[model samples]
Target: MSLTSRAATSLARQTGRQLAARPAASFQQHRNAANVAGNPNESHAHVTSPFTRGASGRQDTTVIPSFKRYRAGNEQGNKVFQYFMVGAFGGLTALGAKDTVQNFLVNMSASADVLAQAKVEVDLATIPEGKNVIIKWRGKPVFIRHRTADEIKDAENTDWQKLRDPQPDSDRVQKPEWLIMLGVCTHLGCVPIGEAGDFGGWFCPCHGSHYDISGRARKGPAPLNLEIPAYDFAEDNQVVIGT
Candidate 1:
């Protein structure tokens, strides 16, 4: 054969061989690309995921969109709960304040009513001479003694300066025969028995205090005379005990 023909035939064989191998090479390349896509460690060229670098220099993937939506819903629900709690607290506080104001008003009204009706009246015509009568006036006991002539003379003749708590018998009575004073003893809050003392007037057995017919503290621990109620005679026998 000629040399040029031989060379051309050889080249054609080589081209045919290369063409026969082309499909296998193409399939091998496609398979390599699929393996690279399936591998977890390899980075994709076309697709990218959002990531952030942390302080440790590691990449952190973004949270899923569904998780972000759920978090936002939770935050909104929390805000609603907080608002409800605040509203309920405000309502309770207002109710408590209203109750306090009402209670204060009620107490003030009751106190005014009590003070307005504190005065009392007493009838003195039933009391006999030289005898003692006890009456209630303004929630305290008042002693009313209708003195006999002899008792008045005895009380007046006594020395006023020699008594422990000194007062003239004439100063204690608006009418000389009527002796009116509180029944409470000056030494303590005990009530005294009328006309039963060493002074022939009132005796407190609880502390052994003695008062005279004129209600002056004569002996024992009593520091002052018996308190006299503010009284005025409405008539010859009727008296008003308190203003």
Candidate 2:
């Protein structure tokens, strides 16, 4: 045959062979993909699916969108629930604060035992003139004196204006013969000895403070008179130290 015809025949045969091999190559690829998916009859498209599809052709995991699922009428109800929650939290917080304040007040207030000792009552018939009686009231020493005539005269006649703390003896006592004052010294809260100082009243040896017969601060570090407390004579023969 001619050279050109021989060349054309060879070219045709090669094209036919390539065409025949394409289907086999495609089948082999399909078989390989099915084997990888553990099902020889399944298509590669099913095996490579990004998500599993349901019978309705939608992804099995699909859910209705939030905006599409929400209804306009439910908005007020949701807001009301939120407001209720906020108000409940605020109420609880206020209640806790109130309880804390009340508990603090209860703990800081004076106790029953302290309140029970607020006042002391004494009978004058047990005491005599020229004698000093010491008693406790409100956790402090109280000096209750039944003064003699001479002591009362000295206390009233003293020049109170010249003292460090100026006060008349008449102001210190309800009666001229009765003297009631806290024994605690004004300088350093020490207990002073009654009727035992240079002033013949009370003496605080701790700081050398002295008080007169009227419980007036006279010398040394004392800056004020001995504190007088509330008292009443209940009857002609009986005196109540604290009333």
lDDT at 68 for candidate 2?
42
Reference-based TM-score of each model = 0.54, 0.62
What digit string (tens of lDDT, one per residue) describes model 1 on residues 114-161?
A: 565465566777888889988776667999999999889988999999
Q: Which stretches of candidate 2 lie over 4 Å from their true place?
A: 1-72, 232-243
| Residue ranges of candidate 1 with Cα displaced over 4 Å | 1-117
What's the lDDT for residue 99 in model 2? Answer: 100
Worst lDDT 10-window in candidate 2: 40-49
* Model 1 TM-score on a 0 to 1 scale: 0.54
Each model's lDDT comes to: 0.84, 0.84
RMSD each, Å = 18.5, 14.2
